[model samples]
Target: MSEVQDSGGEKKKGKKIRAKKHSTHIDMTPMVDLAFLLLTFFLFTTTLSKPKAMPLIMPDVNEVPDPSKQTPVDDEDAMTIILSKNNRVFYYFGIKEPKVEQASFDATKPNSLRKVIIEKKKECESRLKVGGKTPNERHKVVILIKADKDAKYKNMVDVLDEMNINDVPVYAIVDITPKEIEMISGL
Candidate 1:
């Protein structure tokens, strides 16, 4: 409830008359109820933010997979990429006795990692015998990524971005080996 009251009282003739004063009262219960209702309405109607994540698809364990869809990759078809300190990248084409050649993350240069992966992808795709099978069934590039202890996490993220950019079909983040560490230590 709101109310207004006049403060003027009877004045004596010899005394100066005082200015009239008015008092106001405002009830805040309805305003508070309205504010809470608006807050609750907005809270219930708004959607909460979702967590960001990278996707990882795993095979269904219960369902039997058809063997026709699977194509085995040769050892020669494998490509290994190693991430070292300072965002450096080392790549080799095969599994055994890899030359351990260094490639830059730079996109502008000819020997950049993207160029190498794209070239290797094309080569492996060419080597697959897609005789009667559909194009998707053909063998694709398989990349193995390993990171050194000294390597920065950003390098791994960059390599993952490259994989996504090139649409690489098969790849895994494998653990680094001591032998591989020795190979790149001098470089």
Candidate 2:
């Protein structure tokens, strides 16, 4: 009877120990699904903005000179100077055809156009002064400058400085048309 009672007590204790060995696990399926949804939302909703541009203000010329007071003759004195991106300088005098001057610059060297323009300005001024006529009084003494689209800002600035030094004030800038911009952009 004692042996039977001991065996029964040991079996009960073993059953209780087995029952106390418990495990608890949590499911992470919902958290992982939420993370993936947030990633997808960010990937599809963002966009980059276009770059900002600098503003340019050009000089205005509205008043036309009186034709009755002016004498029309063959092209003798009007000058048009063009500065090209390929470092070419062109001049047109009293004619529609332009003459390209053999001129070039080393990208690493200082600009030589400034000196050339200064000399030209002096020549123009001397002609006007010796002839005893002001710029407004002379119809054929005007200087027109047409700069290239890709010319350096510093080069243009040097040109302007030369003009200022020589008292050549009036000038115009050629603009790129909206159609040209569209064609270039393929829009």
Candidate 3:
């Protein structure tokens, strides 16, 4: 077999130099532009939903007691405050069914619940005093709060501040059932 040789003594092997048959070069400019466009689209168009929040730690389902066997809070000094989505404030003496109180709130004027809670605390204290007991009596002032999921966070905070100011320490955050929460959320 005969081999072709260059002037510099390099062997010219195989057929004459041929152009590549199937070049697979990709232009990254368009791809990189598309990636940046997608990133900008996500950054501008995405809407983050508000996070769910609560002050008190919620009880786990496993730790929750049986609803049917739950003892009623019959203590007259016990108070349950419910903040409905319609901005209504209900005060319950001892049961879950809270009585709607004619409470007013001004969004411009903050801490509006303070006055109402002060009055309610006075009334509760007076009732306990008439019953030959002081305000500091153990479990004499339980203030449970049941707040609507859509209720303003500020309102719940105001209620908590009022309870703290009134010295009603014992409190719990009532949780709604899954069904009730679904209904409230219109899901």
Please estimate how well model 3 matches the true structure, expressed as its whole-model Cα lDDT: 0.60
- Pairwise TM-score winner, candidates 1 and 3: 1
lDDT of 3 by residue, 25-103 (tens): 9889999999999999999998888686545655566876888986455466576666667675555465544344435
Which stretches of model 1 miss by more than 4 angstroms? 1-52, 56-72, 130-134
- In model 3, the worst 10-residue window by lDDT is 7-16
| Per-prediction TM-score | 0.62, 0.39, 0.44
**Candidate 3 or 1, higher lDDT:** 1
**Residue 88 lDDT in candidate 1:** 93
Q: Pull out the clashing pairs in model 3.
A: none
Q: Give each model's whole-structure lDDT.
A: 0.84, 0.55, 0.60
Worst 10 residues of 2 by lDDT: 178-187
User: Which candidate leads the pack in lDDT?
Assistant: 1
Worst 10 residues of 1 by lDDT: 1-10
Per-candidate count of clashing residue pairs (backbone under 3 Å): 0, 0, 0
Candidate 3 regions with alpha-carbon error over 4 angstroms: 1-73, 96-98, 106-112, 126-139, 176-187
TM-score for predicted model 3 compared with the true structure:
0.44
